[model samples]
Structure formats: structure tokens, C-alpha cells
Target chain A: MKKMLAGYDAVAEAVKACDPDVIPAYPITPQTDIVERISEMIADGELTSEYVRVDSEFNAASTAIGASAAGARIFTATCSQGLKLMSEPIFSASGMRLPLVLGIANRSLSAPLSIWGDHTDTFAERDGGMIQFYAEDVQEAMDNIALAYRVAEDKDILLPALSCLDGFILTHVQEKVDTFTQREMKEFLPERDPVHTLDPSNPTTMGAYARPEHWTETRYEVQRAVKRSKDKIGEAVEEFADVFGREYGLEHNGLLETYRTEDADVIIVALGSVCGTIRYVIDEYREKGEKVGLVKPRVYRPFPAEELNKVLGDAEAIAVMEKDVSLGYQGGLAIDLKSALYSNGSRIPVLNYIVGLAGRDVTKDVIKKVVEETKEMRGKDPSDIGLEEEERWEPLREELLPGDKDD
Target chain B: MKQIRIHGRGGQGSVTMASMLAKAAFETGKESQGFPSFGVERLGAPIEAFVRIDNKKITDRSQVYNPDIVIVQDSSLLKLVDVEKGLKEGGMIIVNSSEGPGDLDLETDAEIVTVNATDIAMKHLGRPIMNTALCGAFAKATGLVDRESMARVIKETFEGEIGEKNVKAMSEAYEVC
Candidate 1:
């Protein structure tokens, strides 16, 4: 049951256990190994599925959409520029209400060109109507695949799902993963029985054109279903724990997870593999009698606002460390958390620390520095630390940024 | 937890060496993780990989900055990069070279262990794939993983005659260490 597996291989193992009806293959850094393993499984007769070879990620998404429309459970993976190339289909796949699970080896988008770990890819598609789940480690990356399928396929919440794992960090790192048998996985998630599909005999239109009159209502319905999916996802995670014997989220099966935040004064909120690093810093600080904790949001879409408020609101100061930026604004997660706190009528000092971009190492020392800064910002206004713009590039190499020729 | 860093050229199997070490540690009933540096690697380019072994689950995803031990698969990398950059003061480094520890000019507080892994590999496998041989030297020098566990993983990784060749090269390097 326990084996040494890289995150990509672990994801492939989960996909094999789930046994989707169709797999469209496209190669990209980090995510390519996952589909490569799936193809090997199909070719080796271990899995019975239609393995479609596609030249581009756009075709991969299109193929998955077509297969899902035919009432077939679908599995596909892509990230970064590939995800951007599949942007149109990604939106339509979710809009058409296909229960396809998209595995994203989260990577930074390129202009200067980078093939490293970041949240930019998935966070860019945050509003595309797909349910988003960010995994903290190799185990969660594998577990999220099955859990995303279980939740996304629910008739009431028939939205596509994105199971995102940090590129290279988790995808390439080999660690212990407790794999599940096909029988046990099937017991938890039975075969997909779609509520609607494209049938010629009993035809039902999908991805139909929405007129101006119907556009608002269609958008409303999608919004309503996504908002309502929070409960469905919570229930599915509980059932997943019962079936798989692996429980997620600290305290309970909420969208976000809390680590030692019950009595902490300073807490940092982050997502994906970086949370593991932050947890280590928390443990080290806790031993030194410092009330430092971490709040990791496993689910990004349906944005865990209320849950974020619950775990982080009690802290004297909250710092949101993220690998993404909203460009000219602040880190995406920090922007959202600040809005959520503001809506909850809480005036906590939340500092935004943008870090670990383009595979820059976010070491324990960087985290320790953030904690110290958060400690300094305690009980201070946003402007007090020159954070009114909500941007703090912690650990930034100043010379790298465009500045004056001389200091 | 014990952290290890491996320095080698891109084609020298540094990443595989790290993974094999971690797997060997796992075979000894310890939790372990291994991964390559986030570098744009190509053949013959200098690169690094890392491994972490612990009694409990290894959760930190950061690269091994302060390594408890260092492994250099190429003697050339000694002049190219700081192979012992963040090594602990009393840590040890296992280098694959024909020269003695005195010949390799590395100024560090760590102990230096040298083995001519290329010769061992050329003798057994007819190639310069010194990763397995260096792994054997690692086991002998550090005793972090036993020889039996290291051989088992090497055999599992490289099968049939190649596996046997690798094990022989490993044992030869182990004896030299």
C-alpha cells in the first residue's frame, strides 16, 4: 500500500485506480510524466481506456470535453502555458457541466519564460467555473484527484474540477504514498452515472448558445451550483476519509486547513507545497514559545472565505504568503483574504508576502523572516508598515527589479 | 532528519542517485524524500539533487540548503561549483575521484571521503555511470544505509546483468571506502 512515488507517479496511480473511460495525452513539463504513466498503464493492459494522442493541450481539453459529453468519466492533466492554450475549452468544459477532473501541475505563466512551481496557472483560471483544490503534498495531490472526481460528478454540483499540485516541488519529489486498490476506490466512488449526456436518440443540447436574455440566468445558475457545492464537497471529503482512511483539513473537513492556530497570535495563510515548509517554521517557533501557526487553504475556488475568517480572524496578525501576484495589486490569496476579512467586519492586520515565484526557493529562513515581520506588524494599521497597496515582496533581490542605476 | 546533496553533471545520474539513496533509506524502514534541483538541466551541465531521511514523515518541501552530507559524482564539479556550499561543519563529503582527499582542494570543516567510482563502474559496467558505485561509497562512509539495503535497491533499479554489474561496482567501491 505504501510506496515511494513522485507526485506525478502518485497522481497516475490515483487515475489508474479511478479508471476513467478516456485519457487525452499532451506533454508538458512536470505534468507530462503523469499522463505518460497513464498511457503506459493503458498500453500494458492494466487499464481499459481510450488513450487519445493529442499534439496540443487545446486538443487534450477538447477531447476530454467530447468524451465527458458522451457520458464518459474523463481524466486529463496540463499546466502553465498549456493551461493557457486550453483556456477556451477549459471554460466551455465547465460551462457545459462536464464532470471532468483536470490535474494541474501548477506552474508560473511565462513572458520571460519560466518552467517552475507557482499558483499562477490555476489562479489565472480561478473564475472559469471549475472547482479548484490545491494539494499540500504528494499524498494530498493523489487524494485530491479522486476527491475532485467524487465532488465534481455530484449531480447537483456537476462542475469540472481542478486538482492542482505544485510543479516540480511535489511533482518531482519522491515520497511515501499510500495507494488504494481499485475495488476500495470503486466502493467509495462508483462508476460515473451522468445526469445528462449527448445522445442522438434522446438528444439534449450542451454548451448551447445563450442569448442576452438567458445569459444572466445561465451565469446565475452556475454561480448558485458552485456556491452550493461547498456543502457537497465537505460531505464528499468526509465520505472519502471514511472510505480511504485518510482525513484532510485540520480541525474538520472544511475548505481550508489550520495548523496549531487554536491559540496562535500570528498565522500565515498559504496554499500547496509551501504550506509544508510553513508548518515546519510554525513547529520551530512553537517550541520557542512563539504563537506562530499556519492556515492552508486546500480549496481555492468557492474561495473558502468564511472558513478563512474562522481560523485566521482570531489571530492578532495574519500574513498571506503566496507564489502568485495579481499584477499592480497584491498576491491573489492575500487580496481575497483581505476582502473576506473586511466583509466579516474584522480589522486584523493582514500582511501580503509575495514569494517563491518562478521556482525561487522559499526556505525556512525566508519563513522565519516573514514571521518576524508579522510579529512587528502586530496591532498596526496597513499603512504603518507601508502596506497600504497590499504588496510586500519578501526576500526579493532588489537589484533584480528595475530601479535607479545607483543606490 | 539527515539531509544530503548530490553534485554532478546533468547526465551523471545525480537525481537518480538521490532517489536511490532515499529508496535505500526507505528499505531500512525510515521515511525519506528525494528530488532534483529546480534547474533547467541538459546533458553535461552541472546540476544538483537532494535527499532527506527522517524517523517521522518528511514534510518540508524546500531544497536541502544545509546538507548533513554531500556527494560529488564528478571530480570536475569540484572546480565548477561549490559542492560543499552549505554542508554542516562536521558533515562528510564522498567524492568520486582517483585522487586522494589531499589532492582535491576543498576548504571545509567537513571530513572528505574519496573513491575512484569511475574505475569501478568502467570495470563492471563498461561505462562511466558512477552513481551506483558512489552510492556504495556513501553507505560505507556514512553508514546511513546498510550495504544490503543499498544493493537491494540497486538491483531493483537496474535489472538483470546490468543490475549485477552495478552491484559488483558498488561492492568494489564499498571495499575501497
Candidate 2:
């Protein structure tokens, strides 16, 4: 359907089209609408699913675990505090190898009580054993809902997947989204296959406690599958392209979306809706004869180390702009990117800019300045205090971020 | 791209107005996007919402620091915030007020157009949800969106008498503008 749908409603509609067997919903800010819309669908008899509203996110996630173990295809959504409240169960869902999908509207965690958009929620879950796909906008969120199922429920990759999107920024924003019919959704993503589910006749032991002797191997198994899930992600994206006629870095390890980076001397790496702003700045600079480009890493987990090397190796310098931080350290994404580059033998000088935390707006002007700063820091050791003070640029951009007085 | 910002109190349908404008633009086969500020504050707080429409797809997700058009669903918002921040030169300002251009107390090179949207909405919609009515004036003052598309979206949004009444209020203000 050609329609204007908010990312919030779009995810809900996509979930409806997929027709999951069970949805255990618990409402939270920014993500509450997805649940509300799904509840409305169930109420209208438009969808026939066991829609259960639990008391909290923890309960919702726990219910998903119970449902999935009972051979039901489960789905749920949460953000920020809700995600933290249910973190343990999230890891458990993946460990149990349940082919479930969790829709995440990424939001800021709070000591200050903010209900705004940020990646702090999902970034905190980087090691939750669940495969993660970060969507850029309304269209991506809707499409990835269906894609998440295809990747999650693959026979070789019976792992839980989270389709993460920036809260409020993308969730509440309305844009023209092309929605698919149930027939099309079925063609793209079929009903979940219960490969190793709880069966009454053929009873199997599941979620049993592992002693010290076997705990290592059990975790290694999940870690190994987490790494191997990339191939499954690539295959799902390839099949999706073949059927839906839209491509999303399927050839590039289904990892990074390299935009105008082919001939650029400088590039900024970013994620989510902020990439939308970064692309605009890159275009503006390009019009003025600046060789600026952007590489948006869509898959944060299974961090695209090799792809980053190949795509960003030729750049003069690179900046990793992120909305989530590690507090005493640099941003989570920037640190991961630096590690990715180092491991891949790419000697590029990487700069980290922490931006848009707690729903702060990263405007075109902000991104443009970041590109300029990265260009100036080219070929220099960012760790050298003398070089940093000479140009007066903080590698972490402490001055440019929000919630601080001076900048 | 034509950028439009709507300034109003929280419950005055500021974000809804922005969404309808973008949706109407989409219905007319233009690429459009709409968003409210990240602050989901209390009901009476002054807030800003934005809509961007273009011949080609828009990629910028930044807030509209400058807009070609400004629609004031509640004229009181003009005093609370910088309603004219970054308006392009010779921009258009549409206000929901009984006062004429000389009495609006707004300083800008924008062509000032005022419609008593509250009066129109109260008459036709039986309440002061002046967003739809302002869209009507927005159509007449700027012609960014046609009145028919605005009515179609409004009707599609609301159901039964409410939808008919919203369309009626919007259409009446369109002729009045």
C-alpha cells in the first residue's frame, strides 16, 4: 500500500503482515505505539494471534521465552529502561536458539529521566547473543521487520534477532512508506519452522543448567553461531533482493552502506537517522569541491571489520560519529570501529565524535563541522596530546556534545 | 525543497498538522517528511513541528532551522518562542488569529496572512482544534498543498461526523483565506 506511516505504525503493520503465532507486548515510551497498533489489529480480528499484554518488559520478554519454547513464533518490542529491565531474558532467548524477533526502538537510558532517542539502549546489548539489524528510517524499519524473521528463523541460524531503530526520531516521524500485502509478506518471509521446539511426544531437555565443565562450550556455541549468523544474514538479504527488488549491502557482507566513498579523501561513519543528516552534509560539501563521504554501518553486531577495511582503507581520515557512549571511555561505536580498523591492518587515523545523546539533534551544521574537523586531523596520531592541543580538537568531542556547559 | 514549520501548543495538533501536510503532499505525488520536536512534554507547552516536501526524495532528517513557510496554529506561540527563526527572506506566515497583519506583532519580511482559524474551527468543528483550518489557510496563502488533497487526508484520518466536520472547517477556511 502507498501510504504515510510513522516508523512506529509501520513496524506494527509489518509485524501484522508477517502473522507471528504469539506476541507478548509490554508498553514503553516511543515503542508503546507498536504494541498499541498490534493490539488494535488483534482487537479488530484483523490478525489471529495470541496477543498477551504483560505487566512489564521483563514479563513480556519472559513470556516470549515461554511461548517460543512451546513451539510458538514469538515477537515483542521495547526500548531504553524496558530493554535493560529485560536484558537477561534477551540473552537467554538467543542462548535457547529461539527464532524470535524483537523490535527495538532505541532510546536513551536515564539517571536524568529522558524518553528521547539514542543508541544507548541497544549498544548496551552488543553482547546479548542476539543478531541485531539497525534500520535507518521508516522504510528500513518496516522492511527489516520482515527481514529480521528471515534471518532469525533460518534453519542454520535459529537465533533471536532485534531490528533496532532510533526512538522518537524515527518512531514518531512520518514519511511515505510502501507497505506490502499479506500475500507479498508470505512470499518474502514464510511462517516460522519449528526445527527444535518443545514437543510433547518427542520431549527434549531445554534451558538446562550447565556446570563449570560445560559452560564454556555452551557459550562458545552461541558465540560461534553469532559469528556464523553473518552468512545467514547475507543469504537472507540476497534472497530478499531477489524477491523484493531492493538491495541492502548484501554483497558487502550485509554490513556497511558505503555512500560516495569511492573517491573521497575523508569519510564519516555513522548509523540510524543521523546518517540521513550526514549524507546531506556530504552532498553539500561535495558540491563545494570537498571530497567528503559517509559509510553507514547497518549491522552493529558482527561488527563489519573486513568490510570497514576494504571500504575505508583509501580514505585520508575517518570519523566515527555515535549517539551512545561508554562514559569514562569513548563512544561504544567509535571504540569498536578503532578495534575493527586495527584488526584489519587499516592504519587510518580514526576520530570519534559523540553526538545526539539523550535525543540531542545532530543537525547538518554539526555533521559538516565534524567532517571539517576530521579532515584537519588527517595523518596525525589522535592519542598525541600535543597534536590534539595544537589544533584544539578533542578526539571524543567533549566540547561539542550536549549536557555540558562549555563547547 | 519547501520547508514548513508549525508553531502551536502541545494539544493543538502541531505534529498532526505537520503529518497531514506531508501526507497530503505525498498524495499529490511529491516526496515528503514530517516530524515533531523530540520533546514530548506536557500538554500546554509550546512546541514546533516540521514538514518538508520536494520534487525529489528528501534525505535530510535534521530539524528545520529555516523554513519557507510558518503556520501559527495558536498566535500566542509567537511570543513564547522564536517563531521566525531562520525563515528565508520573503517567506510566508499564516496565523490563526482575528487580528490583521498590522496587529500580529510579528516582525518579518514574510507576507503575513491571518485567518481566524479558531473561529472557523469552532463554527464548523465545534471545537478549537484549529490545525485543519490552518491547513486550509495554508493552502490559500501559499498554495503548497491544494484544498482537495487536504480535505481528502483529513477525511481519511477521522471517521463519521468528525471527519466530515474537519473537512468542512478546513474547506471553509480555505475559501475565507
Give the per-residue lDDT of model 2 (tens digit) for A1-407: 77999889899988988888899999899999999999999999999989997998899888888888887888899999999988988788778887778999998898889898888889889988888788888888888888888888877777888899999888989998888787777788877777777888989978778899988887888888888878877887787787777778976867768889989989998888888878878888899988999998888887777888888888888888888778767788878887888677767788777788878778877787788888886776546423343221223455556865564
| Chain A TM-score vs. truth, each candidate | 0.97, 0.93
Residue by residue across A117-202, what tens digits does model 1's lDDT show? 88888888988998999999999989999989998888998888999999999999989989989878988898899888889999
Model 2 residue B28 distance off true place after TM-score fit, in angstroms? 1.3
TM-score per candidate, chains pooled: 0.97, 0.95
- lDDT tens per residue, model 1, B85-123: 878889999899999998897987789999999999999
Q: What share of the true interface contacts does each candidate keep?
A: 0.85, 0.89
Across all models, the iRMS values in order are 0.8, 1.0
lDDT of 1: 0.89
Runs in model 2 lying further than 4 Å from the true structure: A381-407
In model 2 chain A, the worst 10-residue window by lDDT is A385-394
Interface RMSD of 2: 1.0
